[model samples]
Target chain A: EAGVAQSPRYKIIEKRQSVAFWCNPISGHATLYWYQQILGQGPKLLIQFQNNGVVDDSQLPKDRFSAERLKGVDSTLKIQPAKLEDSAVYLCASSLASSGRGLMSEQFFGPGTRLTVL
Target chain B: AQSVTQPDIHITVSEGASLELRCNYSYGATPYLFWYVQSPGQGLQLLLKYFSGDTLVQGIKGFEAEFKRSQSSFNLRKPSVHWSDAAEYFCAISSASKIIFGSGTRLSIRP
Candidate 1:
């Protein structure tokens, strides 16, 4: 089976401009996630979705960031009026649903989109 | 609040030397722990995870980690380092339905 897929492996935009990233999760996967990874730092979870509904998005910047998953398969993350601090890699991941850690469903990650804001 | 900590920012080891990277976590209940590796400009790859039972767990690429509940630590280790093992490693913890990640540690291989 194919891994999680993402579009536009790299992107560059000026401050105040807008940018968007897309993700296609693995088939039959029920959970999808978006994360931001700054240079020299671990990836930070931005939002998580389970079957087209949001499970968590506490870390998302409400004013500048927005995300959506339709049909429970594909997702898109957007940044409006972007700032220089938004320069980071946008990673997408997916995992199968399981009852507990005993089954332990690990997440599969995409190559990620590297965004640079000037 | 749950959190993960990785004190080492960078580490260098000879290709044939042993390697260890430290990780600590703070959570109320037992947490699901994980280690992931990322190559330059690439996405993260799961090395291993620990949920319950067995303090020591083996992962892909000959990597292993020991989970110590008493010390609230999970450390990744490799018997012998390889040049291809050079990458950024991250430790993460999941508790109360929330996942927290450490800052990460960069590993460099010496010829």
Candidate 2:
């Protein structure tokens, strides 16, 4: 089966410019997530979507970052007026729906988009 | 708040040597634990997971992790190191419909 797919494996933008990243999750997957991974650090959760509806986005910086999954299949994350601190890899992941036992399924990740803000 | 901690930032061992990476978590209840490996320019891949049942979970690529409740730790181990095993390893905990990841451990194998 095909895994999660992302676009523009690498990106470069100037500070204060806007950037966007795209993600297409695995087929039939019901949950999608966006994460930001700074150098030498683990990926941090930016937002989570369950079938086009947001499940969690508490950690997201609303002032500069936003994400949406319109059809519950693909997602997009945007950052406006980006800062140097925003330079990091943006990762997308997807997982199957929760089971009757309420167990979280394994997450499949994409190659990620490395955004370099100069 | 729930969190995962990887105490080691980087570790190096000779090829064919044993390897271990430490992980600790903070949560109120039992959590689902996982170990993922990320190679350079690649996405994270699940190595193993522990939800219930056996505390010692075996994963792909000959990786294994032991979940210790008393210590609140889930440590990954490999019997022998391989050059291909060089990668960033992350420990994660899932609970209350949320998942948290550790800072990650970088593994390097010496020839």
Candidate 3:
């Protein structure tokens, strides 16, 4: 089975420019997530989707960031008017939906897209 | 709010030496814990997880972690380390259908 896949392993953009990252999760996985990992820091949850609908995005910077999972398959995250603080690696992860064994299912991650906003 | 904490930013250990990385979490209910390792330029890989019953969990690459409810800690350990083990390690907690990660610990190996 293929693991989660991400595009443009690395990206560079100027401040105030817009950037987008793509993610194709493992087949049959019902849950997808986007996270941002600043240098020397852990990945922070940006958004999470269950099927085609968002389950949580409370931590996401709504004013600048947005994400969507179309058709409940692939997902995309976009940042407009990016700032220097937005420079970080964006990681995509996927897991199976809760199967009554608790909500702690194992998540598979992608290589991540490193976005450098200059 | 739920959160994870990794006290060590970086750790250096000689090859073949024992290794231990610390993790702590804050949550009111029973916690679902996980340890993941990320190689440079690679994605995060699950090392192990603790949900219930067992306090000590063994994982791939000879890694093991013990959950201490009293201390609210889950520390990863390896009896004998290898150079290939050098990577970034993260501790995470699952709460309310979301997972929160610690800042991470960078492991370095010395010959």
Candidate 4:
């Protein structure tokens, strides 16, 4: 099976600028996620979508960050007024089920978009 | 709330030697645990996961993790180290839906 696909493998933008990342999950996947990973740190969940419905976005910086999964297939994440702290790799992953124990269902990740805020 | 902890930030071992990486988690209910390996300039790949039954689970790349509920630990082990094994390993814990990961442990293989 094909893995998740992401575009713009790398992006460099000035602080306070806007940046957008796109992701296409595996076919027939019902769950999608956007995570931010800084150097030497674990990936942090920013938003989660379950079939076009948001399951969680508590950690998302609503003031500057937003994400949407339309029709439950493709998703886009936007970061407005990017800050130095936002300079990290944005990874997109998709899974078959919401239950973590969905062992048969692994979250396939994309190459990720490395954003540098200078 | 569930959280994962990797005590070792970095570890170095010679090639052909045994390896072990520590991971501890805290969750109120039965936790779903996972191990993922991330290479530089690459995405995180699932190595293995444990949900129920067998405490010792085998994953890809000759890696295995044993879940110890009494100690709240799920440590990864590899019998023989390979140069390609050098990468960052993360331990994740989840309950219900949302999952949380640890800071990650960097493994270095020396020739």
Candidate 5:
């Protein structure tokens, strides 16, 4: 099976600019997630989607960041007026949907797009 | 919020030597545990995971981990190391819905 796919691979923009990243999860996977990985740190969850419906997005920066998964398939994460701190690797991941810890499953990640804001 | 800790920020080992990376999690209940590895310019790859039963769990690439409930620890180990093993290692903790991850451990191999 093909793995999750992400685009651009890398990006560079100035502060206050805008950028967007895309992701396509593995076939048959119903859960999708967006995570930010800062240098020397673990990946932090930004949002999660279960069949186009948001399951968790408490960590997302609503003021500048927005994400959507239309038709429960592909997803896009957009950041407008990006800040210096926004320079990080944006990762997209997917998992099989179940329920609870016992029901949920492991996450498969994409290659990720490295974004640098000057 | 629950958290994960990896005390060693960086570790260096000789090529062909044995390797071990420590991970400790803090949670009120028994949470899911996982270890992931990331190479330069690449995304994370799942190394292994421990949900329940049998404290000792094995992972890919000749890696294995021991889950100690008494110690709240899940450490990854390898009998022998290789130059290709150099990468950033991460330990993550997950509940039914939410998850948390440790900062990470940088493994360096000396040839």
Candidate 6:
């Protein structure tokens, strides 16, 4: 089976510039997520989507970051007026939707897009 | 607010030695725990997860994690360490349809 796919494994942009990262989840997976991993830190959940609807995005910085999933398959995360602090790896993961009783399927991750804001 | 913690920032172990990484979580109910490994410039990989049933769950790559509800901890253990095991390990918990990760523990193998 193919794994989650992401584009531009690496990216570089100047501060205040806009950048976008894309993700294509595993086929048939119903849940998708976007995370940000800073150097020497664990990946932080940025947003989560169950199908075409958002499940949670409370941690996301609404002023600068936005994300969307279309057709419940592909997702895009965008950051505008990027700052140096935004330099980090953006990871995408997907899993089968909740089976019931609050059980979650294992999540498969992509190689991730490393965004370097200079 | 649910959270996961890896008390150790980094650990070094000789090749062929036993290895253990610590993880602790804070949640109200029976927590869903997971351990993931991330190599340099790579995304996270699931090592193992604990939801219910057996307290000790074995995972791929000869890794295992034991969930101790009383202590609120899910620690990863490997009987023998390999050079290839060097990487960042994260412990996570799923709550309210979201997963939260710890800061991560970096493992270095000594030849």
**Candidate-wise lDDT, in order:** 0.90, 0.92, 0.93, 0.92, 0.92, 0.92
Summed over model 6, clashes come to 0
Clashing pairs in 3: none
| Per-candidate interface DockQ score | 0.53, 0.61, 0.64, 0.60, 0.65, 0.60
Q: Write the per-residue lDDT of candidate 4 for residues B32-70, one digit (tens) a residue.
A: 899999998889999999989999999999999999999
Model 3 residue B79 lDDT? 96
Which pairs of residues collide in model 5? Answer: A101-B96
List where candidate 2 sits over 4 angstroms from the true fold. A98-103
Q: How far off is model 2, as Cα RMSD?
A: 1.4
Candidate 2 has a TM-score of: 0.96
What docking grade applies to model 3? medium
**Local error of candidate 6 at A47, Å?**
1.1
Q: Over the stretch B1-111, how does candidate 6's per-residue lDDT look in tens digits?
A: 899999999999999999999999999998989999999878889998888999999999999999988899999999999999999999999887778899999999999
Which candidate should be chosen as best, given DockQ against the real structure? 5
Best by lDDT: 3
| Candidate 1's TM-score | 0.96
lDDT string for model 3 (A1-118, tens) is 8899999899999999999999999999999989999999999889989999998899999999999998999999999989999999999999988444325668899999999999
Error of 5 at B104 (Å): 0.6
- The candidates' interface RMSDs, in order, read 2.8, 2.5, 2.3, 2.2, 2.0, 2.2
Write the residue-wise lDDT of candidate 5 on B38-99 in tens digits: 99988889998888898899999999999998999999999999999999999999855756
User: Which residue segments of model 6 deviate by more than 4 Å?
Assistant: A99-103
Give the runs in model 4 whose Cα sits over 4 Å from its true position: A100-104
Docking class of 4: medium
User: In model 2, what is the error at residue B104, expressed in angstroms?
Assistant: 0.5
Off by over 4 Å in 3: A99-102
